[model samples]
Target: MNRSVPMNKAEDISRTWLEDFAQLLTKTENVEEGVTKTFLPDGWLRDLLIFTWDNRSLNGLRKIACYLQENLPRSVISNIELDHHSELAPKYLPLNDTLKCVCSGFKFSTTVANGHGFFRLVEEGPGCWKAATVFIMADSLKGHEELGYELGVYGGHTLSWTDVQAERRKSVEVDPYVLIIGGGQTGLNIGARFRQMKIPALIIEQNNRIGDNWRKRYPTLTLHTPRSYSPMLYQPFPKNWPLYSPRDKIADWLEQYASSQDLTAWTNARAEPIPVYDSKAKRWSVTIIHDGTSIELHPVHIVVATGMLGIPRVPSPTDQNIFKGVVFHASKYEGGKLFSGKRAIIVGAGNTSADICQDLVFHGASSVTMIQRSSTCIVASSTTRDDLLRGWPEGGSVDIADLKAAAIPFLYLKKVLTEHAEEAIAKEKELHDMLRKGGLNVSFGTGGSGCFPLVFEKAGNYWLDVGCAELIGSGRVKVKHGVEIAKFIEDSVIFTDGTSLKADLVVFATGYHTMHDGLKTLFGAEIMDQTGPIWGVDEEGEARGCYRPSGHPGLWFGAGDFYYSRFYSKQLALIIKAIQIGLV
Candidate 1:
């Protein structure tokens, strides 16, 4: 069908809904041209209602009339297509002397002399009028208020209020406890590396056990990317760390790594909205309520390592009351033990689906059907590596030029050359040779390559290949020709193709959504509006990820959106180092 046909319909719907929304917004006490509407807290309430229905429809009109007495914007009314709907008239109630009226939960004094701020409303009619409250402050009082506000009028006049709190600089010993929120490689590495840095860290897992997550993954699961590039924060996997390690081994290794480092991680320590407060002692107060006991602890910094894959959102169950059977998110799967005597249907096309499919077959399942939304760009792990290392049974090195000559087609030679230079100058011959064999070329010099200086070249393509071949070749994990799980019926699941398949279990391995949830509040609306893309660099002309429109000192963020180096741990190390040296 024509996709553009829905475009006009959607816009018309948005215009109608927003018009009603604006009328509802007029109930607030704080009034100005559009100030009341702008202050309506940014949340699902605003997001969902803004573009939901067309004001022209009868149902839409009823919804608008019922929810009208709230704070909404004036632009909404101008855009709304109100033909001859007499019910779409303005509604208002004046402040009476006998009793004070609480419009939109804002209390106004019955006597005019008692009220601090008075507002006006922009109404269309008796039933359609939208009250716009303009503040009536005496000239003298306005001057006094101005003393505490800084004004900047560029795009428009914006008053930034200065915090009136006392700047209490306290002297206290540096707190040492660290709370880690994820169990992935980043979490393990960050904690382990912190240990090396002489900092104590506590890892909290949302799951039941430490490595049980990786243990229950699909059997065909193997690391798609190479190991050398994706080194944990502290140590590299075993010397013979499979170009791709299996699912169970990755988890087992993490557990062992924690044990080896003596990390303070509590399994099942799912930090569910633990209250974190600033203390009078000038440290952070973390109230961890575990096992019915409230543990008050202070940590210098909270390192959130909940990587990209923690939140798995499934398609909304079309009919919540109906469909039964097993519906588990990828994060909760133990194995196919329950799928022993039933046909299983898996959703999503990523690595998790491949792993789950293989596991189901081995557990004596009747049949396994995989459903995917898009064709994945799958490749062998061996292809994404330092070709010579695998080529030579007993690993040795090749000259940079030799590698460039051999892997002529691959355009990554310039990167390899830069790494070679760093290795050669560091006087680390073994590392130098490793760079050479890993398809890199370099010359010893202080003056290096271009903007992407050859120096961090090897670091760029950190994990190219590892265990992808084993997963794709594994017979049990079949690549099905379908996408989008439309709905789940009682005994079968429907696909986007209008076809249904009998199923027992549905696993959604459809990767993680970008984490912008925390940013909406932490940075506020102005900053969020200026934010480019949440996870990566936006191709259009916008600010880079995590970069402030104008840099704010001491107020810095990492991990959320910025793409830095793997030795980014080293970068963090350097930052901490500078802080220690007072050179920051």
Candidate 2:
């Protein structure tokens, strides 16, 4: 088995190009304490290099020169290989060609180091080439072998497990540098990132146990995305894990992750009253109630990782109190078994609504109806796994996939997805027609961007169909499109369309209010207003009030899906670290 053979001509060229780039990068030198310089000329880099660290575009030449000088070690690059497929195609003109490559190799950085690089090369002349974009990320200087012993009891004087637990239990008395609110995926991820940066962070979860957020969801609920796209930092799910994990499985995984990652999380804890920020001290004084005991904590930074929809938004109908039935928000709906042999009306046509409607039908509900107020972007699970996640490496390291996903600019990715949406809708015209015929309203989402952008931009306008569409299309689950509940009548609901439907349970899957609303109770209305909206893309195409500075000092928001938290947690950690070190 000859391992050195190139898979193709493009791979050979890519490998050779990356080797040359690594050689030049290793020769670079630091010019100052935090800055560096390289001999690479101006034309050797792209105008805008996509940085995965914060998903920000940087001046390619300057950032690359600085990064290489600061991070690359002076050692010979070895075992350079094309990690993924690459292609050579014409660029700028017919005479100029571009070579896109992603490669990996090893270098000596205190020890044997691994690095992954994504490169774009352009033919400057017939026989001359220049780098259009060069993005490289290397492993930490410290190797696993060197740090592995620190994780276990190595000496007789080592701290006992009970003592360690006690220290965490008493963390409320000690002023931590950062306090994260929420024990969900976002908070856990931020805690992990802060731990890796050697920053003291305490996570306060209102639930009795970690991962209860997912555990409390409906039994039929499962992750819509594949396992490959939902890994925490440094720890990926085992290959034996389900492709689409169920609610309880994910809940258990999160609990194990928090423990395995050594993140300090105070469960069965609630932030009492509201946190008051002291301007003179530049710290937040927050009171927590745990197990009937009140504890105080003063932290320099407060991160609200309670998710984008931190507070449930249950709309009040004109005559709501008169309804003679069980009424609850989607968040409170445990399962459809309780509604068995009963008529149910689920308000809202989002993913949760769809899932609940299907669950109701499955649980032997006498009648189930979904009241759709607007069009929903519906994409098949297969399409999502096969097309949206097409180029993503299967069974590869999630960190690598995340970096690759981040390499593409958001707007550009949106455009690409828009085109994909158009093609997909065209291919599934019959499915769309069937759903429409079944009284369901569907769209390709805003600006044809489909479900991906809708998730970030609106958070509730789309749903990735996982057999629910089939149920709706087959008329197993009923849908009432283009209308709202005019009022709730006794033992029946009157719609805006002058129609009426009998119901025993009314579930409002009307989504939730922005995280800013949740902050209002914690911080005064003035401070909450200053924070602006939480989720949605900004002018720079990044998440508006997340992983970046909030107008209020020392306050940050960390919210999103698993992959999102995994990527942006580091960014939030870096921002806090910078503030702590006076680098901001």
Q: lDDT of each structure?
A: 0.42, 0.71
Quick one: best TM-score, which candidate? 2
Candidate 1 on 1-584: residue-level lDDT in tens? 11121222423433333354444444333333333332222101111112211101111222233333242332132222322222112212333233111112111121111111222232233222232221111111111111222233432534322211111001111234455656666666666555555545566665666776667665556665455444454455667878656777887887887776555666665544433335353345655545545555576555555543335666775652466767877766777887798877776654466567667777887777666554432222344344323432222222211221221111222334454544334543433344334322323322322212211221121222133223334434444564577777888777777877777777766655554445444344554454444333322111133212213222222342011223233334333333333433
Clash statistics: count for each candidate:
35, 1
Q: Model 2 segments beyond 4 Å from truth?
A: 1-55, 58-151, 154-159, 164-173, 388-394
- Per-residue CA lDDT of model 2 for 1-584, tens digit only, reads 11122334444555556556545644544432212222224322221111222334334456555644544454344555455422212112221133322233222232233444455444444434455444444333223211221555524668787787667646633768998989999999998888777678889899988999998887889988887788788788887988888999999999999998877888998887678889999998889898778988899998989888867888777777888899999999899888899999999988899899999998999988888898888887777777535545466657656765654546656766776666767866776787897899889877777778887888888887876777778887788988888888789989989999998999999988778887788777978877868888875456788887788888889888998899777667655665676645
The lDDT of model 1 is: 0.42
Give the candidate number with the greatest lDDT: 2
Against the true structure, candidate 1 reaches a TM-score of 0.48
Look at candidate 2 and give me any clashing residue pairs. 46-132
TM-score of 2: 0.80
